[model samples]
Every structure is written in C-alpha cells, then in structure tokens.
Target: MTDRLTIRRPDDWHLHLRDGEMLKAVLPETTRHFARAIIMPNLVPPVVTAADAADYRDRIMWAKPKNSDFKPLMTLYLTEDTEVRDVRAAAEIGLIHALKLYPAGATTNSQSGVRDFKKVTRVLETMAQIGLPLCVHGEVTNPEVDIFDREAAFIERVLDPIRREIPELRVVMEHITTKDGVDYVAGGGDTIAGTITVHHLVINRNHILAGGIRPHYYCLPVAKREEHRIALRAAATSGDPTFFLGTDSAPHTDAAKLQPCGCAGCFTAPNGLSILAQVFEEDGALDRLEGFVSEYGPRFYRLPLNDGTVTLEKGPPVEYPAQIETGDGPVTVFDPGMPLYWRVVD
Candidate 1:
C-alpha cells in the first residue's frame, strides 16, 4: 500500500473566509494545507467592486498566519449594478480572479445577488471578451422549485441558456451536487468546468435529514441522494480536468447552526484535506487526488502552480477538533463520519 504521498500544494477553487474574527480563525486551517484559494465574496454587504475586493483581500492578508504565503484569489459579487470597466480593470491588474453569481436569495448573504440576468448581459459580454471566468453558485431560488432539484433545474432554466448565449464565457459551476451536474460539466466542453466539495462527496441528504436532522451536515446546495453522492465521487476521482476541488468550507457558529432556521454551510476547512485523502484512498484513486485538489484548479484559472508541497502520511486514525473556537463563537467542524488515517505531516 502507498502509505505516504507528497504533491503540489492544493488550491481551493471555492472558499469562504468570513471577515474579522471568523476570517482569522479559519484562514490558517486552509493555508496550512492549501497554497491559495479563490475566496468567496458573500459577505454581509458583499464584495461588489474592484475596490471592495482589494479591501477584502487586504483584510484576509492581515488575518493570515505569520510567514504563510497563502494567496487569496479575490472575486466580486455580481449584481445588476456591477460595472464592466471595474471588472475589466480588476482582471487586467490581476486583482480579482472571477466574479460570482448568486441568484437572489439563493444562500446566506446573497440578498444583493442578481435578480435579473438581463441587467448583467453587458458585464457578461465584457467578461467573455476579457477571458474572466464566472464562478456560479448553480442553484435557482424560485420558491416553487424543490430544494433537491434546484441544481438540475438551474442547468436547464438558467445556466444552459446563458452558456448558449455566450459560449465563449468561461464558467466554473461551484459546489455542484448532483449527477445531472456531473454529466453537464463533463460534456460542456472547454469553456466550462465544475467544483465538487469534500462534504458533498461524503454525505447525502440522508446524512442530514435521516436520524433526526443533523444540522451540522446541513449546507446550501444541500446534499442530494446517495446516487448523486456516488456520481460526485466518481467525477472527482475520475482524474477529469473538467472537475476539481472547491471545499465551500463556510463556517457558522454552533449557535447559529442549532437554531430553528439554521444557516446552510459545513465548516470543513479544518479537516478538508484529511477527509479528501481518506475519500480518494478508499475509492482506489489515490493517484488522482493531487490533480483534483491541486493542479486542475490552477490550470482552469490560468494561474501558476505552487512551488511548495504538502505530504500526507497514512497511519493510525488522525484526530481533528470537532469544533474550532473563534472570537465570535465555537464553530462545528465537518465530520466525515469515518476515521481518517491519512494526515498531512508537513
């Protein structure tokens, strides 16, 4: 058996490092294993402009651990009011990596997301022209669409039409959670790719709704059926360049999670790499883990791979904290529900 492995330091194609106290607490969990991440912009007010992205990036840098060379690839929250020139400038100077699209009311802090896609056509055209990829939270917010079916509905009702209209606009379908999602991205050709979260690969809806509602397993673009989870695992472990890792490791305090109407997110950053190693090892795809977590993301983003490496050694079960304390409150970590034998030793 391959008990030890080393690869290029990974990059999270999608990550959420909330501001202030939350940012300080979670930044290290990722930087310790990942060299860079495409930081989410779903803050309260949202990072909507080049200036907003710059300021947010600065705060992240300040909060990172000393001597950590973790880079935050910033993104702007796309709204009807987003300016084309600002996006162009951000892309030109390499200040922002992509612009995120959150259908209004799709998830937490998405109140400012786009309500009308028409309003952003000019911006989309500009992005396609400049080769700036759009990272999408691929779910529809319509009240009538069943939560479980939102992702597939999105591809037909929203994503497909948009792609057809602007075939040159590169897109990353973030946190894709269904077989439909896997099939779509696999065949979507060069301009499209998908990101699969570690949590989704391990859990299905039963992990949350079964056994009396495990709130911690709850997350937006909520986990689908076991069949879908199987599909996600296959796509992620298939070594296909069309799929890569995006933890979507959103952290919310335990207090917030235990409420009657709790927030949707799994704080997986703390043990994401460990869980991924375990998952890949089980599937007999240990050889492909590096490309999924480290290489494909950078290639899709048109960025250089990291010079450093992280080593994971497989031995006894690795214990990780169940919750991480922050200035705000204690945030529960995602439990893969299986003992992980591989731990990053370097």
Candidate 2:
C-alpha cells in the first residue's frame, strides 16, 4: 500500500472566507493547505463592484498570516442591475477572477443575488467576450420545487437556457450534488465544468437526517441520496479534466449553525486536505489525486499551477479539533465520521 504522497499545492476553485473576525480565524485553515482560492462574493452586502472586490482583497491580505504565501482570488457577485462596463473593467484590471451567480434567496447572505436573468444579459455578454468565468450557485430558489430536486431542475430551467443563449460563456456548476448535474457537465462542451465538495463526496442526505438532525452535516444544495454521492465520488476521482475539487469550505459559527433555521454551510477548511486524501484512496483513484485537486482547476480557469508542494503521510489516525475558536465565536469543524490515517506532514 502507498504510505506517502506529495503533489502540487492545490487551489480551491470555490471557497467562502467570511469577512472580519471569521475571516481572520478561518483564513489560515485554508492558506495552510491551499496555495490560492477563488474567494466567494456572497458577503452580507455582496461584492458588487471592482472597488468592493479590491477592498475585500486588501482586507484578506491584511488578515493573512505572516510569511504565508497565500493568494485570495476575488470575485464579484452578479446582480440583476450589474453593469457591463463595470465587469469589463474589473476583468481588464484583474481585480476579479470571476462573477458568482446566486439566484436571489438561494443561500446564506444571498438576498442580493440576481432575480431576473434577462436583466443581466448585457453583463453575461461582456463576461463571455472578456473570457471571464461564471461561478454559479446551481440551485433555483423556487419554493414549490422539492429541495432535493432543485439542482437538477436548475439545469433544465435556468443553466441550460443561459448556456444556449451564451454558448461561449465559461460556467462552473459549483457544489453540484446530483447525478443529473454530473451528466449535464459531462455532456456539455468545454465551456462548462463542475466543482465537487469534500462534504458532498463524504456524506449524503442520510448523514443529515438519519439517526438525528445533524445540522453540521446540513448545507444548501444539501447532500443528495447515496447513489448521488457515489456518482459525485466517481466523477471527482475519474481523472476527468471537467471535474475538480472545490471544497466550498463555507464556515458558520456553532451558534449560527445550531440556532433555529440554522445557516447552510460546512466548515471543512481545517481537515479538507486530509479528508480528500482518504476519499480518493477509498475510491481507488489515489494515483489521480493530483489531477483532481491540483491540475484540473487551474487548467479550467486558465491559470498557472502552484510552485509549492504538500505531502501527505500515512500514519496513525489524526485527531482533528472538534471546533476552532475565532474572535467571532467557536466554529465547528467538519467531522468525516471516520479515522483519517493520511495527514499532511508539515
């Protein structure tokens, strides 16, 4: 059996480093493992302008740990009223790496998301012209639709129409959780790709509802059925360039996560790398781990690979912290519900 492995430091194609105290606390958890991350734009006010992205990036830089060579790639939240000129300028100056599309009321702090797709036609056109990628939340907010079916429905009702209209647009189906999502991306052209999260690959809806209501296991586009989880694992470990790692390592304080109508996100940054190593190993795709986590994302985004490398060693089970304390509060860490024998060796 393989006891040790080393690969290029990976990049998170989708991540949520909440602003302020939460940002300061969780930033290190990711920077410690990932070389760079595509920072989410769904803050309370949302990053809507070039200036907003610039300011957010500056704050992230300020909060970064000393001597850490981490880079936070910024993104703008797309709104119905977004202007084309602003997006073009943001891309031209490299102030933002992509535009995040969150259908209004789709998820946490996403009230400012786009409600009318037609209103953003001009902005989408500009993005395609400028070679900017669209990182989508991938779930429709229609209350009538069953929560488990939203992702598959969104592809039929929203994503497909948009892609057909703007065939050249680069779209990332973020945190996709259904076989339908997998099939869509697999059948689509090169302009489309899918980001599979560690939590989704590890847990299914059963992990959230079976035995008890495990809120920590809950998240938007909530984990699907076991068969779907298997499909996600297959796609992620398939070595297909179209699928890659995007932990979607969203963080929420324990209080926020346990309260009435708790927030939707999983705090996985602390153990993300270790958890992924286990998943790939279980899938018998250990040899392709590098392509899934490190190679595919950069190639999809047209960015250069990282210079640094990180090694994972097979050793005794790692005792990960149950929760990480931040100035804001205590944030619960993701529990993979199994012993992780492979750990990143410092």
Runs in model 1 deviating more than 4 A are none
User: Candidate 1 lDDT, tens digit per residue, 183-202?
Assistant: 99999999999999999999
Angstrom error of the Cα, residue 264, model 1: value is 0.5
- List model 2 lDDT by residue over 144-230, tens digit each: 999999999899999999999999999999999999999999999899999999999999999999998999999998999999999
Error of 2 at 296 (Å): 0.5
Query: Where in model 2 is the C-alpha error above 4 Å?
Result: none
When summed lDDT is taken over every stretch of 10 residues in candidate 2, the lowest stretch is 88-97
Clashing residue pairs in all predictions, respectively, total 0, 0
State TM-scores per candidate: 0.99, 0.99
How far does residue 217 in candidate 1 sit from its true spot (Å)?
0.4
Weakest ten-residue segment in model 1 by summed lDDT: 301-310
